[model samples]
Every structure is written in C-alpha cells, then in structure tokens.
Target: KAVALQKLTYLSSLHFAPVASHPLAFPAIELIASPQLPHRRLAYLAASLSLHPASLSLLPLATHQLHKDLSPSTSSAANHHVTALALQLLASPAAAAAPDLPVHLAHDLVPHLSRGSPRAIAAAARVIAASPSAAVPVLFKPLAACLASPDPRASAAAAAAFCELSAPPADAAPFLPLAPDLYNLLTTSRSNWALIKVLKVFARLAPLESRLAARIVDPVCQLLARSAAMSLTFECIRTVLTALPAHDAAVRLAIGKAKEFLAAEDDPNLRYLGLLALGMLGPAYASTLHECRGVIAQSLGDADSNICREALHLMMGLIDDSNVTDIAGMLVSHASKSDPEFANDILGAVLSACGRNVYELVSDFDWYVSLLTDMGRNLHCAQGDEIGRQLVDVGLRVQDARPELVHSSRTLLIDPALLGNHLLCPVLSAAAWVSGEYVNFTKDPVELVEALLQPRISLLPMSVRAVYIQAVLKVITFCCNLYVERLSDSSKEVSVALNGLSMDQTVSGGSDAPIGSSNGQITVPRMMEKDPFSLKSVVHMIN
Candidate 1:
C-alpha cells in the first residue's frame, strides 16, 4: 500500500533498530508513527534486516487491518510500498543465506512483483537476477498475465522481468516457442527501447541453444532491409554474426543471403553494418570477398576517409586463398601508379597477406617488387609502423627481386667489395627468418666468396670490402635456403631464388654439361666437398 505508506509519516520514519533483540518494540512505535511519509519511512525501516523478524510478525496483522481498509485508489500506493519492502527484504543477505528457507519463494514473490510501479518491478527483476533459480515457473505465470494489463507501466515492467527470467541458461535451453511473443512486441509497438532491451537479452543467451539464431536473423534482416530503426538493425547484425558461427548449415545458408541483401542497400549506416557483418563471416564464406569486392573497391574512392579505412579492413578479412593474387595485383597496380592513400593500404595488405602465408597473393611478383620499392622509400611516413616494417619484410622475401633490390641499393649496399657490410640492414634482419618455400633467388655462396677473395676485388677500400662481404653473406644465406621452384611457364632453368641458392637441377641449356663445346678452352668445374656454396657444406651459414 504505497498510498498508506505515503500517508503515514511515523511508519516512513522508523529506522532499523541497532539492537537485534527488540523485535516487539517496532509495532508499538509504528502504530504511533504511522502517517503518510512516516508510514513509507516505517515500511522502509521494517524492510531492514535488524527489524525484519519483528516487522514480519506484525505484517499479517498490518496487511489484514490497515491494508484491507484502503480503497482501490489507496491499494495501488499500498501495493507499491509492499512491493518495495518485499524486494528490499529479498535483497538482504540474511534472508538469502538462511539455510532453512525453502527454494520456492515465488508463491509470495509473484503477487508483489506482478503488481505496483516500474520501480517495484525493476527491483523485483534485480532480486531475480540475484537468485534466478528460486523464482522461475511461478514468477513466469503472473508476469505473463501482467503482459496484457491495461496499465502501460505494468506491461513494460512485466516484459522486462520476463526477459530477465527467460535469459538463456547453460543448463536450460531457452524455450524457443515463446519467440513469437517477443517478436510481436518488437514489431507491433514502436517501443524501440523495450524491443532493444529484449533483443539484447535474447542475444546474450548462449548461441548453442536451439534455433534462436534463426528466429532472430529473419526478423532482424527484415528490419534492416526496410531501414527500420537503424541502431536496432545494427544490434541485430551484431547478434546474428555472433550467433551464426554456431548455427547449422541451414542457418548459415539463410544468413548468407544477408550479404546479397546488404549489397543492394543504399543507407550508409546499414551498409556499414552489413559490411562489418559480412567481414565477420569471412572464413566460412570465401566468396564474400568477391561478393563485397565491388563495394569495398568503390568505398576506397569514397569522399569519407573512414569509409576507406573500413573498406580496407573488410578487404583484409575477406581476401581468400584463391583470390588473394587478384587482390594483390589490384593493390600493386594502385601502388605502381602512385595512388595516394590507396597505395599505402595495398602495401599494408600485401605485407599482411605475405606474412600470413596467403600464397595466392605471392604470384604477382612484378607488382610485388614495384610495391616493395615504393614502400621502401615511403613506408616510414605511413601511419602504422608495424605495417611499414611488414612491408619491408615482404620485400626481403622476394627472391626474384634480389637483383633489383641490389641494383637499386648499389650506391648504398652492392658496391664491388662491400659484400660484408650491412647491404640490406634491418630488411635482412627480417630476411633472416623468411622461408624460401615459394621462390629461390639467392646468389651462390661459393661464387660470392670467390668473388670476394679475388685479389683485385679484395684490394678495394675497407668500407667497400665490408659492403661486399655483407652482400656475400646475405647472398649465400639466400641461396642456401631456396625452396620454392624458380621456373614457371615463362622460362626453364630460370631460378627466381629467394633466401637460398638455385641449382636448377634441370638445365635450361638442354644438357647439364657445356653446350656442344668439346673445344679445348671450355670446361666444367668439379664439385668440392668443402665448398661453402655446396648444399651440405654450410653449417648454419652465418650462425
């Protein structure tokens, strides 16, 4: 009786007695103090643990004597007070921890929660959230009954409490048949707040619980397609993405349609959310890259920089094992022509694709080399250093490009006697770990060592000699580690060796011997067991 509580001043003012012993003292004090706010104060007091037992002893009499006399108008306020007191009581640690208390407290709990204002209803939800098991099927009944109540507040509160109680449990699957009711609320009323809250609760429930994902995906997709409540659509997108990973094939199949649907969407907000959701669905659907590629490519040219950034991020996720080469080609084409920000995005993507072993991207060697040089001069100026550094690493992994790299850096690293100097510097540091799985381009160690040892070449300035030696070591290591086949459809015995030596076991010259040269001058050198250039001769090469 909030009305009575509001009317009784003395009842509202009674604070919890400090002494635990005076159970009988509160009733006499409440009787004298009961008037309007004082009654609310007393109800607040009676709700406290120290005074709980004493107040409970008198509640039966008070409910019968005082509450019965209240008219319907007064009953509403009285019910509010009673509901508040009930919630406060349940929240007490003493009541919760009492070992002898029966688990089924919902019989008494239902009426208090089902009646009263939103505050009381929300308080009841908190108590249920605190201890859900003790208030289940019983709480559900009146909550369902109140959902149809004439009072909007009662219906709203009932919806809130029902959502909390029905939140998915690890031990119990959410009863899916009830979804229609929730969906009805979301669709029938423009109560976006209530709908959003309910949807969130549904989303929070574990994904593995039956067909919940399917149920939400269709309805949400409709909302998204119609551009109804864009934020809710975004939330639905997030919820579906999160849940679809656990869905059966039928669900994934249905979810796949969202990409096609979103591709046609004109609303930037929905399109943005769609791209994100599609990106999140990446590994499961490689075709998504191709599907979104047009949109993503278009976004790169968008007036807004954030659109470009997001498009690049999506491109990174959607690029696949099969289509990566095409993607890299696209990136490199941009870089080669000096497209401003796009060249930078492609450079970063190339490095990432290479580092992560997205082999399809590695086939565009010509473009790859050009991008490397472009990035080499400008990577430092870019926003992300790690991306810049990774670009350099990709550059170092290039076997076919070593000659180009050396040629470009000739003034700095490839001078005649400068083999031992830091020709590649930090690039070589990354090169030290790069594998030769795909390309073989390194110079023969024996040839490099011999070139360095020649008296005329060795006599150059120390700085020049040091540079040669560094080049010799880098070349030798590169040749030694060569693993990927060098020859492609373009040529035979052409070893585009990376990180290792290229022997080209099959000779391009038709035979492994000198070509028809039985002349006295031409000769084949014999293999030496101790030759550092020999495959078995190097011991951890530099190490």
Candidate 2:
C-alpha cells in the first residue's frame, strides 16, 4: 500500500491538474481513508498535488478522515507526528481555499497553535488569514502568545506570521498590543530570521505610534552594529530610513552601512539595494544622498540595468533649483551615450523632474530651454511628445522664457537633418509653434521664415507640416510688420537686417542665463540667438 501510494504521488506530480478521467485522481482521494498513517499522509499529498480548486468538494471523505485524526479522543491525535500530518493537510492551500475547512476545523487548529506547535503555527496562521471573518477573537491571543513561547521555533514562526499580518494593505494598528512582545524578541532573540521579521512589524508600527520609534531604535541599532548578515543590516537600514529618522545616531549608522553596500563593487544587487535604501531618505537627508554622488554617478554606467535605474532615481531626487542645471546637463550627456532603452529612461526621468509642478525647480528659463532642445536632438531620443509639450508649455506659462524658447525653436526649425527624423517631428512642431508664437524673440525673423520652409519638412506628418506652414506665415507677418514699422524710416536698413538671417538655422541651443541683465542689457546665449531674420540681420547673430 505504501509503494502504491508513492507511485500515486509520483503520478500526481506529473500533471499540474487532473481530470475526472485520470487513473490516480479518485484512487488518491480514496487513499485518504487508509488505516496506516504513512498511507494517509502520502494520500493527502497526492490529492493536494492532483486536485484543482474547483474540484475541492470531492474531498468530503478526506475531510471527515482529517477531522477524525485531529480529534483529541483519537489515539493518533496524541502522537505529535499524527497531529502534525493532520495540521499539514488542513493547512494545504487547496483545503484552506475551501469555504467550509475553517468552519469545520478551526476549533481543532487553535490548540496546536496555543501549545506552540511550530508547524501548526504557520499553517494555522495561513488558515486563519484565509477565513472571511478571521477567527480573530478566537485565534489572535494564541497566535500572539506564541511570540512569548520559550521555544525558538514557536517564536520564529509567530514572528513571521505577524510580520505578514502587519505588512502593508493589512493595517498594523490592530496588532499594536503585540509590540511589547515583539520588542522583547528584538532585544533578546539570537535568530537573525526572527529578528528580521520582528523588524518588519516594527517598521510598519513605528509610523503609527510616535513612542514606538523611541523604543525600537536602540535594539535595531545594536543589531545593525553587531550583525554580519547583510539581510539583517538592510532591514535595520530600512527601519531607520522609513520609520526612525528622528534617531540621528541610528540614521548616520544606517547611512554608513549603506555606503558599505555601495562599496561592494562586484555585487550589483548590493549596490542596487544600497541605492534603494538611500532613495528612501527624505529631503532632510539630501546631504547624505548627495555625498554619495560620485558612487551613484558611476553606477549609471554599470553593466547592471537595475543599478543604473536606481542611480537615475537617486540622481533625480538630488535635483532642485540649485543643481538642476548641472544635473540636467549630466543626464542629457549620459542619455546620448546609453543604449536606446536606458537612454529614453534617462530622458524621461529628467523631463519629469524638471517639468514637475510646472517647472518649479527651474530658476533659469534660458538654461532649461536649452536643455529641452538638447534632449530632443539625441538620435535614440523617443521622448519627442513630452519635450514638445514642455517647450510649448514653457513658452505659454513663462513670459520671460519666450525669447529663449523662440531662439531654441528657431534652432530646431532650421535643422534640415532633424526634420527627417520622425522622432524629432513633435519637437519640430513645437519649435514651429514657439517660433510663431514668440517671433519677436528670434534674432532674425527672415531667416526663421526660410528655415521653417526647408524642403525636408515634407517628411513631417501633415499635422507637423501644418505647424511649419503656420510658423512660416507668422515669420512673414512679423517681417512685414517689422519691415513696415521700419519702412516709416529706412527700407534699406530693414532689408539689410533681413538679409543677414541664417536661413540654414543652427540646431545648437541651450543656456542657463537670463535673457536680460537687471540693467536691461541683453545676454543672448547658445542654442538660440536674439536677432530678426534677414541675411545681414540674421548673419549678425547675438553673442
């Protein structure tokens, strides 16, 4: 019978699901009624492996036998192994999914948990959690009591269960009373795994109670200091970063440990995790994150994509009104050098950071406008739509930015090479719009008109072509108006101003300077110029 049960178990493992036609399915279910304990346990295993959730109801006989073995009056129940087999069967995911399992077996399950049966604790916790109305009143006390159990097995199992229970999406507030017991475990337990679980629970709980952070800080720090285990150290680092920031001493220790994680040159995962831990620090810890800039920047070019991504996230987090220009320059340069996928990710991150909250971090519109044009010009650049929107958006929202935006727009408009790239079309369209909207800002409008009408613009979508045509009309209108305004004086000067304009407008654009000094002196910078478009007018570009 044992040999036959083993064969059945082997067959069950072959198929993820069994049909009614399978040879082993019904026989495995019948074997659950076997008198021999080994036969019963193996039969349960076969049935569990073979059966699908929908067919769980076929287990009425198996369920009845399980109840019999679990009953205290039964001679088998007195045998710990027999009781463990019954608990294992009852706790199996297939059985636990059954709506009636908890209803029929929960009363029997609670005692094993109360007595600190290690296996029973994990399985029963799972079963209790699955119940629609968790038998919280009947089950929680025993479960929490297991934390205080003298046996390490019971304590570890209980801590793991509570860690899961108190995790996010499951409110930890209800488990607050368990904190005292968890604290005891934290202070005394030598088991690294158990301590990690307890730390998880405390991490969530600390945010809920102001005083809890004070209680757990010292022990977590001691663990951080004494433990050689990377996992435990990371958990402590996370607890500090997430919930115990007020402890300056602990936070500094965590940051020091995180830098050690970054220092692991051969292990990409540790480096990635190090960046993740550091990223969790709030604005107050910006200096610590900034101090790791050299290591983080090096990570951007690492062979591992995960480390690169984390590095990019931390880099974006470091930006503000003060360093946005320099950081934006570094990212744009890096994007140009990366493969297509990571390049686009870098571009997207920078665009999001600078553009977040209506360019709140942007202090110099000139520099930002230049950065936008530089990003649009990358060969692998696929972020055209957003770049286009930001260009037009900045022009509309920032009055002082119109001149720089116009210069940037003219830079894009005149690029015959860029007009061929479908990816650059959105940027071109935005440029045309900006050039048209703020034609007065251009160094020269006549040259702007000729560039807008460049032949390669035929490669543009009809929508973008429409934009080019509109920009051409705007430039013409501006020239006619400016010319007429000048005609009242000297048509020759107007013609000379129009003639110097560079019809082959330069694609180079970007600047961090304001358009004009406080004394109203103009300071034109790269990527765009301040001139009206005509050969001589455009030819004499602003410096």
Candidate 3:
C-alpha cells in the first residue's frame, strides 16, 4: 500500500506531462478497494489528479469505488472526505466526459444536503451546484433548506448552488418565494462571503422580476452603506443599481454610497469601480451627478488608462446642451495631455459627442468653428481625418441653420496660419469643399480666391490636393463669370479691379514671377491671358 501511494504521487505529478502511457489507475483502484480509510482517501485523491477525459476506459472503475466509499456504512470522517473528493472528481474533465455521471451523483448526493455535519452539507451543496440544470428541480428543496443552515460555510455553498440552479428563466420561478428570506440573509448575515453570494443571486433575479428587485433595494443599499470591504460594496452597488429602478430612493442611496467611495477611496481600482457604477447611474440621475462632475473629470487624468477611459465615457454620457462646451474643452485638454496612443480614442469620443449633440449644444457657431479648427490643427493622420469630417459636417449644419455663419467659418479656414498647419489636412480639405460649394456666400470673393492658393499647397496629400484644385477652379470660374457680366455693362471699376488682380499681370506679361511674391500677392496667370482650365497650366502646377 505504501509503495502504491508513492507510485500514485509520482504519477499525479506527471499527469499533465506528455506521456505515452498511464499506469496509475489500476494501483489507485487497488488502494481504494483496501479496507483502510487512509488508503481509500489517498486513492481517491490520486484518481482525481491522474484521471482526465482522455482516460475514458477507467472512469467506471473509479466511479464505482467513489460510490462504495459514500455508502452509509463508511466512517463519518471518511464519508465527509470521500464526499468532498467525489464532488472534486465530478468537476473533473473525466467525469464530464461521462454523460450520465452527474445525474447519478445528484441522486446520491441529495440526501446529504440535510446531513447534520456542516462539511458533509457543504460538500453536497457544491456537488449539486456542479450538476446539470436538469437536476435543479430535484435538488431545489434540499438546497433551499441548506440556505438556513447554522454553519455559514454550508449556507454560502447552498446560496451559490441555488444561484446556479435558479439562473434559467423557467427554473427561476421556484426562487420567488425565497426573496424575503434572501433579503433577510443579506441584511442579518455576519459573514461577508455569505452576503456576497446572496447579493449575486439577487442581482440575477432582480432584472427578471421587478417587484422582487424593488423589494431588495433598501437591503442592498444598507449593505453598501455599512460595508467597508470594497469587493462587497461593489457587489452590493451592482446589485442595487441593476435590480432597482433608477428613480427609486434605494438607487439614490446606492449612488450616494458610490460617490462616497469615489471621494474616500484612493485606490485606482476602487475608484474605477466607483466611476463605473456612477456612469451607469448618470443618465438617470443627471442632476444628482452634476455635483460630481469635477470628480469625474479629474479621473480623466488618472495615471491608469482604464480609470481614465471609464471617466471619459461617463463624462460623455453626461453631456447636454448646458455642459457641452465645458465637457468638450475638458476632453480636448485631456486629449492633448494624454499619450498619443490614447489621444485618438479620446478625440474620437469628443467628435462623436459633438456630432450627435451639436444642434442642441452649440448656440455659438463661431465658438464651434474655432473648436474644430483648434482640434484640426492639433490632430494628425487618422485622428485628423475624423476631426476634419466632423468639422465639415458641423460647419455644413451650421451653415444650413444660419447662412451668415458661412463667412465666419470661411474666415477661420482662410487664416494663413491655419492653412499652413499640414496636420489640419482634413479641415483644410473640408474648408476647400465648402468654399467651392458655397462660393456665392463669400463676402470678399477676391480674398477667398487668393487664399485658396497657399504657397505650401503642394505639401498636401494627393487627395486633399485634388480638393484644393477643384476649389480654386470653382472660385476662379465664378470670378471670371462675374468679370464677364461686369464687362458686358462696361463697368470701369470691374475692369480696373480685374487688371489689378496680380494673376492677370503674371499671365498677360508672361512673367515667371515667384508664387507668393514680395508684396504678399499670389502670382497666378491673368484671367483672360490663359484658360483657367488649360491642361498645360494644370500640368505645370501639378508638377
């Protein structure tokens, strides 16, 4: 027997290793057949460690030995240990491979749930918890009785098992009657572990039944208020918020506790949890959350990215017409301060919020335009692409609502400093498109025309360059059409202004004047000296 024990230990160690053969099963069975309790316990332990789903042939022999050891004739100590080992084995991959094993064990284990020994009851409850859902009805009554057991360990185990069995919609009906009793346990139980288990069961049941959820809100809030354990507090908060309606007094109590957690707790993880709870509650309790806006915004700068992200999302949800500017500014500040890796995601969230809320939040279109221009100048690559699109979209919407705002946006986009910021390619591209599409809206057509041909236009990507080319052609064509109309009326001012336009001198005189000449003039071909759409000039400029 001692030799068998040594061999078992050695084989168990190698169970997970790549081995061609397993030789420990027969010896383990031989040890179990021994009349000695010690040998039987070791044999069961060895079998659990060495047996796996792949060892299908030896499963029945091991199951038979476990069944015999669980008989009433077995000693109490041996019976408890054997039952524990049986529960452990049932959870093993080998037992899972045997389709009928759990059903058989559930039948054998149901009687042990009412046993006087706490260990026996705990072990039995664990086995029941692991049993298939089909066995829940059979074991429900006995496990429910164990919920009131004197032993905290057994009660916790029973609560866990009951939660698992009661998870299905059809099976949940049986637990309705136990709601008050579960609440009683949550409030009166001294053991945090037991309360946590009960709270989990409550969380699952509350969403399905409104009355039960409503009833437990006070008790869950009480748990959150008094508990110092962060894990228990978090679980209680989740249970209360998830199960109870947002307007319930109990939910307010829970949110209050979460606020306390956010302020008092220095741990980033706990603060993160607090922020998450508040985030879920924010939309329903916007007024209540207003006080914590500073606290939530502070988390955006948290050293931990997860906390920052959670805070950002929560802040985004809190945005309304009243707070859009403040929230948007905070997001932009954080984006600028954050690592480049996270900046894009933060900016993307900002743009999304602005797009969805712009009509309601933005009363001052100028301020909105300036915000986009700043974001565009600061952003680059993919981040710039999204911001630019949002800028164009917001600009067009503003233009639609108030046509007068088009000149303001055009002025901002035409600033030499802004046009030179290559990072603002999308913004520039959007501006170019807008200028072309809304050419008649420009207050000073000549200035708009000249600003389109910045010296560094060639530095733009091919796509944006194409947009610039289209914009310039549209503006010049519009100008030429206006010039022709003026000539037909013989307006001398129109002729003089057209001649003063430096583009005419460069083309008419055929001078190779440098672009952006000494007098800050744009050197382009004269309007009548060369065809605006000539292939030769287009190729020359493109080159």
Residue 132 lDDT in model 1? 58
lDDT of 2: 0.79
Structural RMSD, model 3: 6.9
TM-score of 3: 0.70
> Would you give me the overall lDDT of model 3?
0.66
Off by over 4 Å in 2: 1-31, 34-62, 72-86, 89-96, 132-134, 209-211, 444-450, 480-485, 488-543
lDDT per residue (tens digit) for residues 344-396 in model 2: 99999999999888889988988999999999989889999999999988888
lDDT of 3 by residue, 1-543 (tens): 546566657755666641114465667666767767677667766665655455656666666766765565656775667666666665554444454556666666665666634444544444555554655667667767877777777777767766655665535665777776687778778888888888878877777787777677777777777778888988887877776755377787778778877886468887888898886673567776687888998888888999888988888888887878888887777777778767777778877777764456677666666666556655432467776676667656656532443465476556766655666777778877877777767656555655677676777788987887798788767766655664567565444435545333332234433344355443433443354333223323333
Q: Please say which candidate is ahead in TM-score: 1 or 3.
A: 3
**Which ten contiguous residues of candidate 1 have the minimum total lDDT?**
430-439
| Highest-TM-score candidate | 2
Ranking by lDDT: 2, 3, 1
Candidate 3 runs further than 4 Å off: 1-73, 76-83, 92-100, 116-133, 164-172, 204-225, 244-253, 280-284, 357-366, 394-428, 440-461, 491-543
True-vs-predicted CA distance for residue 38, candidate 2, Å: 8.1
Q: Write the per-residue lDDT of candidate 1 for residues 164-276, one digit (tens) a residue.
A: 66665633244344455666665654566666665665665536455666666666555545645656656655565666555545335434545644565465655566566
TM-score of 2: 0.79
